[model samples]
Target: MATVYLDYNAGAPLRPEVAAAIAAAWAAPGNPSAVHGPGRAARARIEAARAEVAALVGADPAGLIFTSGGTEANAALLAGLAVPRLLLSAIEHPSLAVAAAARGGEEIAVGPDGVIDLADLDRRLAADPRPALVSVMLANNETGVIQPVAEAARLVHARGGWLHCDAAQAAGRIPVALDALAADFLTLSAHKMGGPPGIGALVLADPSRQLASLLLGGGQESGRRAGTENLPGIVGFGAASALVGDDLAPDGPTFRVGALRDRLEKLALARVPTARVIGAGAPRLGNTSCLALPGLAGATQVMALDLAGIAVSSGPACASGRQRSSRVLAAMGLPDTVAGSAIRVSLGWASTDQDVDRFVAAWGELAGRKGFTVSAPQAA
Candidate 1:
């Protein structure tokens, strides 16, 4: 049986070009920090990759700090801040939420649409002391709903707080300009964008801000992070960034995943009356749709799909234990049963119309049991 993967949100397969670049980079036997001829070649690859990444986000290459991945980037950036309060959206990934927890920060609530409430954010900022650091994601990993990061940034700046955006899910799917977004700090993951895993970056618009080191070792990342750089991974990440430009366009939808996704959802709802689309009314990414089939556990749906030769995930990819209601869905005001019923089908660069059809057929068989109600999941 042929297998179809519909979980791109968990991570994308590396592009062929990116894989070739990594192979070529790994063949080189010199550290980027060394000054010998071999070392110079390695350094050149790293610099070129930096340039490619800078171009993708319209950021200065000098402002980018390469790290192992998004988790490390968020931990390092948030752990270093000395603000009076660390305000993070409730819908953020575990990386930011964990960092905020470590710092004893407060969790800001989001609306039923899965977006941060600007008014609520303002209220929190007003009551807190000056120089707060606000952290929010550009697009949510679970729901694929785009956040109002630019407006959040503007409000943070007006109240003398620094804005940090975790663009892990948004970097390759949407247009992300560091200058245009006006965020002080931003984190991105390469694997989320068809690049190799283990290489990601953080961009700080204001380099003058004092950043403390999370690891203690020989100077790397300009002493902001320590340890030998993942040179091959970095090179692959740079090449992937260059590839992303080809996918973006000004008209229609730059990516076609959403159309196919809608077809799957439409069929599921038509066949399985109890089926519901989570965050259907909100704006979502072209590649993702989290659906809830009432009365069925998300884990059951995931297992059913995998057995059907279609791969999908329930909630965050990092989630552990038996699949239950997701914190994100619960925060959006869904009942435990509704949240637990959710399964995510995310398309990627390789996804095709045939894959969507396969998913629609498979979903109908698993979730179309009797007594199910097909309705949109309510947001908090």
Candidate 2:
């Protein structure tokens, strides 16, 4: 049996070009911040990658701060905010909320459509006279619902607040223009966009803007982050971003993963009864679908698909090992039955039409079995 990977949102496989870049970087010897010859060579690679990442999101290379990954970028931003009140969209990734809560912040609500309620945000902003930071995700990790971040930025600024958009999921799949999005700060993860897992960037509208460093030492990342840079990971990420830049140009198919998702969804709906597609009525990433089957636990579906050599995710990968409803779906006002039954199918550059067809076929066969639901491994 052949294996099919449909969980790109969790992490995409590194492209051949990106892998080559990593290999080359690994062979080079030097600290990027050092002034020596080897250091200069490594520094050159870092700057080139910085430019590539900046190009992907329409940011200036000088303003891009490389971090260990998306989580650190988010933490740095949340920790740096000077707000008396910190407000985050309920649908944001756990990293955002976790960082905020660790610093004493509040969670704003989202509508059934998974979009932030602008009016509600306006009200909250009005209630707080102190400087506020409104953190909203550009694209939801689970549902792929794009937020009205530009408008939200306008609203936030009008209320004398700053806006931070977590653009981790949106970076490669959609065009991200910092000036157009009006986001004061945005986070990008290389792993989500076909880069190495250990590297990512925080694109700040102003590089000089002070943010508390999440890590300390060596004064790297322009003192915003401290540590010896992960040079190879950074190089691979740069290579990935450059590739995305080439593919993201006019009339490119960098995001054709969605087409495969639609095909699988159609097949699943046609073959399975009482199956409901979560976020069906909402605007989601083309490659993601959160489907629900009553009496069929998400873990059951995930494992069944895995057993058939198809890889799909359940609820959120971040919520691995737990059998709980998606907080994102719950925030969207979905009932437990719908939320708990949801399994995520996300495709990427590696997914093929046959993968989708196989998933549909496997789902049909499993759903038809007499003991499919009862035999599934319980969430550990």
Count of backbone collisions within predicted model 2: 1
User: Which window of 10 residues has the lowest lDDT sum in candidate 1?
Assistant: 371-380
Where model 2 places Cα greater than 4 Å from the true spot, the runs are 249-251, 370-380
TM-score for model 1?
0.94
Q: List the pairs of residues colliding in candidate 2.
A: 258-286
Models 1 onward score TM values of 0.94, 0.94
Q: For model 1, how many clashes?
A: 8
Clashing pairs in 1: 112-379, 112-380, 273-373, 273-374, 274-372, 274-373, 274-374, 332-380
Q: What lDDT score is found at residue 279 in candidate 2?
A: 71
- The C-alpha local distance difference test score for the whole of candidate 1 amounts to 0.84
Best by lDDT: 1
Q: What is the C-alpha lDDT of each candidate?
A: 0.84, 0.83
Q: For residues 1-380, could you state the per-residue lDDT of candidate 1 as single tens digits?
A: 78999888889988999999999999889988898999899988999999999889888888788999998888888767777878999988898887688878888888887888889898999896667889989888988898888999999999998999999998888889998888999998999989998989988887666688888887877788888889999999999999887777643234566667777777767767767788888788878888887778888888888999999999888775555578898888888888888888888888887887788777776654434543332111
